[model samples]
Target: MQAQILNLMRELQRALGLTYPFISHDLAVVYYISSRVAVMYLGRICELAETAALVERPRHPYARLLLDTIPDLEMSGRDRAPVAGEVPSPIDPPPVCAFHPRCPHADARCRSERPELRPDGGAEVACHAVEEGRLP
Candidate 1:
């Protein structure tokens, strides 16, 4: 199926000189075909950065959690901690940062007010703790 899809996309790209949008939760597939990446949580974009940068140095807590789940030689001997708690409903996200409820680094301000997407090094993150330099 993957082979067929790739062949079809190549054919379409050659015929029309246009690229097709591929959407999936599979990080591997996204990394393979995309030049940029947008990380989201609870219907909100938490981070947007170059694929390599985001994977190597994730700024958002949720993005870090997602990257940590990937199997890698660097983490061969270590146990990858699973992301905790259930995802909140997107239909009614929290008033503040939507990820605050599950974010281990969340502080008082994170619970009270929403954070804006701010540039952090090369990535953009919507985290109060990150903005205030509270995150270690």
Candidate 2:
């Protein structure tokens, strides 16, 4: 039923040459409906790219983590690492990288400096680790 509705919506959008911004935590749905995607973290657009590009080659750690949370039928027997840690308070956010406390690649620089959204490959990503080639 949901798939049917989504297909109908897409058809209508195409017929009318309309753009609809569909926001959801459901990665599969986002991948199905969107031409482009923007990944946000701590009220910032951490990564943005075409859906295929974003799904296949996410540059930001947070975006990658979100993709990893999608359940895979092939990995049925293996344990999936769940998205770790709570979302930081937007009202009183961290000074440096908001993801520093949870990020595995966080260094002194990440803890002290904030990263800007910069063009990386086909997407825009905000991560000092990515900018420094520490993560691919």
Candidate 3:
């Protein structure tokens, strides 16, 4: 039923020359339906990229974890990496990068400074690592 609705939406999009924000928590579903993808951590948009590029090479640690979490039939025997850590409270969250608590790439700068979304390749990413050329 969902697939049918998505197909109809796609048809409508083509016929009407319009776009729809198809939101979902399932990374696989997002990859299947979205041309662009945005990853949010603690209500902040951490990364935005073309679905293909993001899936192939995620620029942010949180986005990488999300893509890695997608179940793959080809890698059925491989163990899944756990989602990093507990999410910080949304109420008056940290003053720094929101994902710093769980980000493996986070450093002192990330713990103290908030990153802004900036263009990198074909994406807009909010990570000190991406800005510092540590990740592409």
Which candidate leads in lDDT?
A: 2
Instruction: Mark the regions of model 1 whose C-alpha exceeds 4 Å error after superposition.
Output: 7-21, 73-75
- The TM-scores, one per candidate, come to 0.82, 0.87, 0.88
For model 2, residues 1-136, the per-residue Cα lDDT tens digits are: 9999999999999999989988887888898899999898778788989999988787888887787777776865754345666667889889889998778778999889989989988888889999999874
Clashing pairs in 1: none
What's the CA error at residue 67 for candidate 1, in Å?
0.9
Who is ahead in lDDT, 2 or 3?
2
Worst 10 residues of 2 by lDDT: 78-87
What is the Å distance of residue 22 in model 1 from its true position? 3.4
- Estimate, for each residue in 62-117, the C-alpha lDDT of model 1 and write its tens digit: 88888887778665675555566667788988878888767888788888988889
lDDT of each: 0.81, 0.84, 0.83
Error of 3 at 100 (Å): 0.8
TM-score of 3: 0.88
lDDT of 3: 0.83
lDDT of 3 by residue, 3-109 (tens): 89878887888899987787789776787678888898878899999899999888887888887776686866855457676688999789799888787778999
Stretches of candidate 2 above 4 Å error? 76-86
Q: After superposition, how far is residue 99 of candidate 1 from its true place, in Å?
A: 0.8
For residue 130, model 1's alpha carbon misses the true position, in angstroms, by 1.9
